[model samples]
Target: MSTTNKLLAGAAILVAAYAGSSWYVGKKAEAEINHQVNEINAAIATQLALSLGEGEIKLNVVDYDRGWFSSKVNYEIRIKSAKDEQFQFLAQDHLRHGPFPFAAIAKGHIAPLLAYSDAKLLPTKETQPLFDAAKGEEPLRAHSFISFGGATKTVIDLAAIDYRDEDGNQVLMAKSEGQVDYVRKGGKEQADFTMTFPSLSLVVDEGDLHVQLNGMRANGSITEQDKAQASEGELHIDQLGINVENSTQIFIENIKTASSYEVKDGLLDSTLTYDFGKILADKQDLGQMQLDVGVKRLDYVMLNQLSQVDDLDSMDEDELLPMIKQILVNKPEVYINNFMLSNPAGSSTLTSDVRFATTALDPVENEELDLGHYVESLNADIRLSRQMIKGYFSGENMISSMADMFFNSAAEEAQEAGLVEYDGNEAKLALSFDAATNKLLLNNKPISVEELVQILFSMQMGGGLF
Candidate 1:
């Protein structure tokens, strides 16, 4: 062969080799992606099985298609009771992911990535109408994103959740969008999530009673520093208005609330604020009302654990009381840093710190403990405005009548002792519990248990408990 012919043959061989190597690399990349996805599906199925407890679950992989750099997967999940003839829950999901880079897999790392996924929740034939209504609103779409092996973030968007029947028509309409981030660090998993309902409205209409909630927008986020122990979160609402037309008419407008909390090392700190911008009853503007509260050193972890009882629905009182006692004994100190309520009338403030002296707690010995024994360690401070009382009792309700009678009986004593002053419209009182004498002091004056009971009885009976 001539020199030119030999050079052409060599070029052809090199091109063929390159093409074959490319095909092999593509195939291997596809296999690795498929394997990871299948592992995820299997883990999901296992979790569903565990969550079902006594119920049964079935997972079906409907379709899987692989491409050179992309893949699609479709699956369905169904659950049914052991005795039931029909499925109790059902959902179908479709996922499309990738531009899988062979280089990343070879390097043992997958960088920032996103997958598009959507789902449909199927209802039984009996509840078809409700499900139809939901689907008619919009399809549920979710997108998953992963960033540098740090966390998997999922974003979901939905139009509405609605239902209708002859007895009542109910609907929750909103542009609901949410994001959830799951991260793992040091053998512990945490989640930080946020959800927003931009235009939320809930309405219920029946024969005579028609209730509606409108102009409700809310967003919230929760961050768990330690899932088993600590978390911090906040929720904010823009506005919520409610109207009820029935035997009694109620109208509330511009209701807003904001709350946040933090927990770490067995101590919890929290703050909450609520505002009733305006309230109208029978078309009478009551006024703007607001409340604020701050708390610290609360046993939030124990409280959360106590709230999350295993199989609580199946546990009877005989099996529950001891659990409650144990939880109370293990509870840590709680301090109310500040609590204030303000309205058109006036404002009241309260602060308190309380803790249990668990000298009597013996979890293994099964000893019955009385919480009252620990109450004597609490310390409290209170301040109230006389206008606050007058505004509360000024109405023509039954409570006002009781308050009037009680105040009349105490008028002479209050005047003689000069303990009640209306000029400043404010009153301050401090309370402390003395363990040595087992006495409770009010304004540095020790009061007997009987006297305390009478005072509390008068307050409750006269509608002063608020």
Candidate 2:
């Protein structure tokens, strides 16, 4: 062979060897990236535990394939409290690009998903269960929030979480940009959302949904498809505000607030209102509370997430009762400036203002009246302000006996004792709190607050004599 031919053959071999080496490196890099993702997720689980320190965390991590050259890593962190409540959080998605030696990393375009499930623990002995749960549901959340930088954003929501269909579709969908805390679980366009499961065609379904829209609030709104589930506890920002239909989705429209969490009476409350799009719904069930609930009448959930209530621990049972009493005033207010809920069943809209009042809740009385027990003092009045209350007699009884009053408060007494007379829908209801007997009387008869109390004081001083 001539020198030129030999040189060509040698060059070809060298080129082939370089190509083989590159293939090996690329394959190993892919494996390493995947392995790293798993490791990152493992670390996240420990890093997100409620008692945050060096290694107590929870996470929902998903491995995404951007392309042969690039990959997207998405996931969320979920911290939990003792109650069956979750604190949601968003973690940065780790996006890796290019060949190993010159790989690149980028952050997500829209904020990543971060939230926990509407669940709680069973008091297991395990130190952490979210790590296991996070891995299981990370994929579902990934499909829930994935946008590759588009002009017009898309929103998909999943309501009717508790109801299911025959075709195995249980998640009801309402779409929009970001998520509104309250979706129309009872709307007309009720559709099941399962992007991961493509076989099920869109179908109409039956479920309880409350969809509200004010002509002024939802007129210029555009809706996207809402189909996402976070099995693992992670928060997804893809769906913010009620982009769908029912968005009294009032969030922190223009207020700057920090993030925090509160646990009370065995319930966990998330207290952060992020950006202008944060879903800060007032939970009627888990109303405003703080770790130091005994000391102050401050709301620890929304406006006061960062507020450190004074004398949290030093408060005694005496101090704490009043504070807890204060929570009753902040019950959820559903004000329909202009409301509309349209669907197959029916729809109604009207302007209304509902105020949550803590008028009279004697915590001292409540604590003593636990279980099926209640102390009652019945003060029957005669003609309470033309309300025509017949008799001005009072009696005290146990809840067991009190329940009799609910059914037969005056049935037998009215017949046997001939206390009062006559009535048909004029039935009234009031529980006269008994400080001594801890009893409550069900007045299906006419009565006044002042007359009722007077009867009670008279009974304490011995019925007829006082």
lDDT of each: 0.54, 0.31
Candidate 1 Cα lDDT to native: 0.54
- The stretch of ten residues in a row with the least summed lDDT in candidate 1 is 414-423
Cα TM-score of candidate 1 = 0.62
How much is 225 displaced in model 2, in angstroms? Answer: 21
Clashing pairs in 1: none
Highest lDDT: which candidate? Answer: 1
Candidate 2: where is the Cα deviation over 4 Å?
Answer: 1-69, 74-76, 83-315, 318-409, 412-426, 429-450, 454-466
Count of residue pairs whose backbone atoms collide, per candidate = 0, 42
Superposed Cα deviation of residue 49, candidate 1 (Å) = 20
State residue 167's C-alpha deviation in candidate 2, in Å. Answer: 29
- Highest TM-score: give the candidate number: 1
Q: What is the C-alpha lDDT profile of model 2 across 18-66, one tens digit per residue?
A: 5555444334444543543454453333223222222223555544444
